[model samples]
Target: MGWKAAEKLIRHWKVLRGDNVKKHIKQGPGHEGGIFTVEAPFHASNFQVLDPVTGKPCKIGVKYLEDGTKVRVSRGIGASGSIIPRPEILKMRTTPRPTVAGPKDTPMNLVLEKTYEPKSGKGMPELINILNDVANGLGSSTNL
Candidate 1:
């Protein structure tokens, strides 16, 4: 997808990760960050969650930076029964040896079959016209 498309998707999802550093500073003690930040602490490599069925602790996944550096996040239970943690520290684990590709020997044409409809025609035309103008401008400039 293009930049505009990706931006639209982000706007559509409206998933707020957490507050900015400034918000954290201004909010002071009682206000905990968003759900994602609260869940981060439980994501530490050493952190473990008890499995109700087995009554055993299961290790959580720890995410690393692109350079393979371990990310350190702060996680703590606050006075108001809130959990706080660094974004990097929280991670979720996936099943081991998950399927890389779909069923083997499947035809290539059937790879992607998902489609999404526009929410409304309100902003669609404007966005499309803007992009069309930009493309036309680029094409004309190249020929000049």
Candidate 2:
């Protein structure tokens, strides 16, 4: 009995722009990583726009057929045979690159110029020392 609802959903469903607009296509429910073609539902008809001049799957690309109008060329190819499509995005959905916070002076720098490279060439500091130093620096001389 949801005929009206179904019709409304179909009418409002946005057209899949192209492979460029989509990040991933569901390969299959059982497929590994669930990624495949950039196109959704992977339909051949959606990519059937042929170039008007050369006419073999439009390798020449979508062009103005004696009439001027702009459109995305097939495979991102252009009038000049230029490979216009940007190369597939490498490292898709990767975690943000760790920020290289340029040359920041840490809290330890307030007492010593460098934290990692100790003046005494000491190894890692004890947690108690760290707590004591931090407390003393915060205007407290009490030992932890």
Candidate 3:
């Protein structure tokens, strides 16, 4: 690789490796300095996803199965013919959904309860009364 290419590769490697360095800006804060970790935007080319079945480096490709489900597959040279399972990190949700209802959660019966009448364009009288009470409480608090 040429100097520019090598430099670019090194920069990418540094970012991926989480290389930390003490940097000082000549323009601002000339003397005061601390270790500043590099931010992301690491190139995808810097790493390769290994094939799960063969344990070999391979390029990914999208393929549809007979069941009409689309999945990632190894396609490039020396690729293993196996369906790549999605990484657990990718499958994970930032906030996982609760499997069981909590005490604060509204009961299914309450959620399914018919509260509105399409024919009269009016909500159930009980809900209206509860809403009015809540509004009154807010108004009283603000007045205080």
Candidate 4:
């Protein structure tokens, strides 16, 4: 699968980050209902993953928390266009954000380069199955 396809699949999973929760919360009088506080259960510290082929970092997803702290939580990839998984999926999972000591605590720079290599063999079909599993898993976990 091409980079475009991989990006599309990754993008779909981005919603799991809980960035849109505030918009879904209802407003009320006694409580600041609309203003919901969403603590990122998982923090993505290293936003840019190095492409094996290009040597350049590909901007995979947004890095929450301005601090350079690794948080362990359920994490997934997001992309645009078609959905395709790399032959070797490099994923990182972490919890809550850590305390920053110095300037390094700040969010990492965004790598806007599209440096993904085209996937071979199982392409779109395999990607569909993977995405389905991810979607189902996300749905069930959020219910709890």
Cα lDDT computed for each candidate against the true fold: 0.45, 0.50, 0.72, 0.46
Clashing pairs in 2: 51-58
Per-residue lDDT of 44 in model 3:
58
Off by over 4 Å in 4: 1-15, 35-87, 90-144
> Measured by TM-score, how close is model 2 to the native structure?
0.19
What tens digits encode model 2's per-residue C-alpha lDDT throughout 14-46? 455455554654465766554343534433344
Provide the lowest-lDDT 10-residue window in model 2: 78-87
Across 26-70, the per-residue lDDT of candidate 1 in tens digits comes to 344887554332212111344444433444544433456688866
lDDT score, candidate 4, position 17? 42
Q: Which stretches of candidate 1 lie above 4 Å from their native place?
A: 1-66, 75-94, 97-99, 103-130, 133-144
1 or 2, greater by TM-score: 2
Per-residue lDDT tens digits for candidate 4, residues 10-102, read 654432345534544666777655555464322344344554444454544333345764322222443231222333333543564555655
lDDT of 1 at 39: 16
Give the number of the best model, judged by lDDT.
3
Listed in order, each prediction's TM-score against the native is 0.17, 0.19, 0.36, 0.17
lDDT of 3 by residue, 1-144 (tens): 799988877665525433633344344554654555545455656456889888889888889999999898987878886888888897789898989999999999999999798798588775566667777774343332
Ranking by lDDT: 3, 2, 4, 1
Q: In the order shown, what is each candidate's alpha-carbon RMSD?
A: 19.3, 18.6, 14.2, 23.7
Best by TM-score: 3
Error of 4 at 47 (Å): 17
Show how many residue pairs clash in every candidate, following the order shown.
Answer: 2, 1, 0, 16
